[model samples]
Target: MNGEGKVVCVTGGSGYIASWIVKLLLLRGYAVKATVRDPNDQKKTDHLLALDGAKERLQLFKANLLEEGSFEHAIDGCEAVFHTASPVKPFAADPQAELIELAVKGTMNVLETCTKVPSVKRVILTSSIATVFCPKPPLGPNDLIDETVFSDPSVCEENKQWYLLSKTLAEDAARQFAKANKIDLVVINPGFVVGPILQPALNFSVDVIVDFINGKNTFNQRNHRFVDVRDVALAHVKTLETPSASGRYIIVGPATVTTNEIEKVLREFYPDLRIADESEEGTSPLNYKASVAEKVKSLGIELTPAETSLRDTVLSLKEKCLL
Candidate 1:
């Protein structure tokens, strides 16, 4: 069969990133069987169903991230399986119960199921940049934040960076499982992802942009590399198509921005936004790095600039009446 005719399964199909992956897969003429927690929820699954090729190419399955073998039926007869489901809340009521345990269990469940699926040749895992570095790391000029670096698990619990801990441990577990069971695995570690909202519900990353424009952020002090959600979606598809794409790839934009820069950019497009002026809040002094050249060259992908990412985000939010 041709590349476009292959069947692929994407876990957590209703999620922010997963939703876009499902859309692109169907657009590429690949049959998609998407797993969601509740396929019957029109509020959650309607956007995916409304896609152009969804009627003929997309299938929805009721699956749970923590349920063992829940993904097998959806993944059956697929050449590739994309595992994008994970706990992403920055602050959890109970760190272990809400984030840590679920992340590891979900990763294990998906990888185990892949082992049993002989038809699955490749597994693309949607991990985050949180796995590559501590949530709060000491940065210096030219100190690279790339695939080679890993988060320090020892301090995440104390620092309240449970999200990082969850991703780091889960990715480590996946690598080990793939080695032992002989499963082909590739990891995509994307930075603070922001872009047009394709789903009915807002993702945590885009929610920050909404809050920024609406004057919800009272104080700001953090640095991040923003990547377009659309670009990230394409990256996942490219990884699946490229035969040489293996190991972990860090997906991110070209700029490192502070909260003030974000506000200024948003204000450029949304003059009526209530975002507070942080002119006095000088830009963060840290020169944090994201080593993306190698990955971009390898994938032959062009990244959208920060302005495009933020601009489309605001437009999408307004279009969706989210703002």
Candidate 2:
């Protein structure tokens, strides 16, 4: 086992993508120290403790992302850290305090703790595609946005897109901190993640599907890049395992999909359900394509087809009686 004697810490242990990462890490034979808000909460910890290798290899630690030194106890002896916890709420009464500050401060606290821990090696930050090419830039018809391109923070703030702003600032803060402290940092920027839900409740991304099916969505009608939650998890592990992987990597499905396209697919899978056909006037349609370059492809990831991902997501929702 590649992870036979290795130890890793995963923040946000019970989250949709984080849970899958923990599962894969445990399967690889790594002793996992997973951090959550409440370790005693059965609803959150049970699913994690029930994973195949979890009984012996998994440990749940209580930590708050915003509190300094909260992560040290869990990260103390770990060789690798996967920081996946971030505020998913797009709108809040105080977006600056609740979203941006929390994300950046929490990320700094985790990195600060990592610096204190001698055993820590690499830190994998779960960033979103929103950080890249968001608030859509003016582009030529043939343009393709990649890692080098970043979302304009000023533009995001002007538009009140606080979630995107938070991710952008947080990732920037992480990069600067990692460089100054000399910590090996690898970032995984995944697009709209969809697939099975390991956690008992639905996450923001999966809820997008639910909202669509229930005709309750107010999300903008625009093209979006989609990726399976499992693929996102695998990318995190692969980035950690592959020593050569450094800097930022975009993780997304092969093609971009629109709201109508997604609804079309869902209608096929769940013909009985009344899915929404309309969307509020939102961001304009993308003029340029957004995709992953060869750098991520070099990791040898065979992406799951978008249809398969959508079908599997709904099936999982049904299994959980969420649909």
lDDT of each: 0.83, 0.86
Measured by lDDT, the strongest candidate is 2
Show the colliding residue pairs in model 2. Answer: none
> Per-residue CA lDDT of candidate 2, range 1-323, in tens?
88999999999999999999999999999999999999999999999999999999999999998888999999989999999988888778999898998899999999999999999989999998778766446455577767887778887887788888999999999999999999999999887788889888888889988877775544656565679999889889999889899999888787877676777788886676654444444453244565564568778888888878888888899998887
Each model's TM-score?
0.92, 0.94
Worst 10 residues of 1 by lDDT: 277-286
Candidate 1 Cα outliers beyond 4 Å, as residue runs? 135-139, 258-260, 272-274, 277-287
Model 2 alpha-carbon drift over 4 Å, by segment: 135-141, 279-281
Error of 1 at 156 (Å): 1.6
Give me candidate 2's TM-score against the actual structure: 0.94
